[model samples]
Target: MPNATGGQPPITGQVLFYKDPQPLSAENHGGLGVRQIAEPFAFLRAAHAVPVTVTEFGVAAASYPIIFVGDERTPVAVMGVRQGQNLFVDQNGYVFEDYYIPAFVRRYPFVFAADESSDRLLLCVDRAAPMVSNQPDVPFFENGQPSKFTTDAIEFCKEFERQRRATTDFAKIVASMDLFEQKTVTFQPRDPQGREVGPVQKVADYWAISEERLNALPAEKYVELRNNGALGACYAHLVSLLNWSKVVNRAVRTPPPGQAVS
Candidate 1:
């Protein structure tokens, strides 16, 4: 994993599983249905990437039908959305329009997870939040009574605000880029069996891989990569707009390139 600034890389690992005790019995099943889970990953595996899995077994209420949004057998980055309304399975079996996002959901579109018991939704940090604090949760089993959810939510909001204050200007740069004008590309990779897979995403695996490689390069090499599209055009544009002027001027004002002036 690389820090937000694209610094201090850490080993990236696959997500293993995410499970809720709720039985799969819901009428509409929503996005947590087994079909959705198995299908997307079938595509990811075909693309030569590891798919997160739900490997463990647990009791699921027969009355509600087990809804496995994700499991231990395969781990994928997930954005959990809690729907409070019981859209109960319709006679036709599909959930209502309001149930799923009108269109396929793009990942990290929201800032935080929604409250299962409340109407308010949490957008993931990738959304418009100012900042979101990442607080690890204490493990709780099937019967565990958890009191920290509220506290954690508050802390997350606070940290989000703090980080927002720090990076507000940077965000402005992205906004100015007018990415909305561009048509985002997505890929439907195939499995070994040639079955199609994964979610409709912003870009293909090649672009994502290229971005990672570019982030690992030294500054000058990174510039060269950007020109070649090995890195992202947006990142290269940002560098031209900001760092080239501000960072270089700050360095020049201080002293010789390698020396600190007292």
Candidate 2:
């Protein structure tokens, strides 16, 4: 979807699956609404990684190897080793096992865009989304006010915005401490005989919190992190790194189309 104010880039860049994002308003979308879809999450099929708020580190840690990426140090849940595949989600839009679903996925088709002129947040939807219907069973508005479904969606987007702010603050705190380091996840091919074969493969490289630096911090600075709620997030991120093996193994089990399958 386009950005919140329409067509322009998102002020907040996590607009992962939105293709034609447009601000929701009674005048513009009085008749548009969403419908139930057999594959509500089909959009996630190609999204190998998605942004996650700091609050999600505790729960998302169990399912995704939470890693920091990009110049912004934005945290993302690694779903697939390759760029275009999501190992946990199948072609039919089925999520394998009981993997922790990120709120970013669940909040699809609806997002908040900032109105730069007034500095207000506007709720937007991906009009190109398969579930968005011109004649929706549940309309976006009723009697000139937002319908209950629309109201609920608005609340969800608002909560996500709140979480986004908190996550930004946490990232700043971590950056200020200079605790991030370059990290990589790799795979080594093996033969049927269970012996190592071929060259050691670098699956992906990104940023991660440095445990060594964290432990070496001054006592008062360490206490400051603990008091700021970042200490737990640091541990959560470090603990989550153990799951990188799972991502590598999954890529080996079902390598993307061009890659050699293990």
Task: Mark the regions of model 2 whose C-alpha exceeds 4 Å error after superposition.
Answer: 1-14, 257-262
Say which candidate scores most in TM-score.
2
Those runs of model 1 whose alpha carbons end farther than 4 Å from true positions after fitting are: 1-156, 165-168, 177-181, 188-262
Over 55-95, each residue of candidate 2 has an lDDT whose tens digit, in order, gives: 99999999889999988899999999777788898756777
Clash totals for all models, in order?
37, 6
Query: Please, what is the whole-model Cα lDDT of each candidate in the order they appear?
Result: 0.26, 0.85
Model 1 C-alpha lDDT per residue in residues 1-262, reported as the tens digit of each score = 1011111112222221211111111121212111122122111111111221111001111111111111121111111111111222232433323322111121211223333444443322221211112222221111222124323433544454344333333223323332212222333445679786776433211111123443555687656544544234334322322222222233223333234558
Please tell me which predicted candidate would have the highest lDDT against the true structure. 2
Error of 1 at 132 (Å): 21
C-alpha TM-scores of all predictions: 0.20, 0.91
Task: Give the backbone clash total of model 2.
Answer: 6
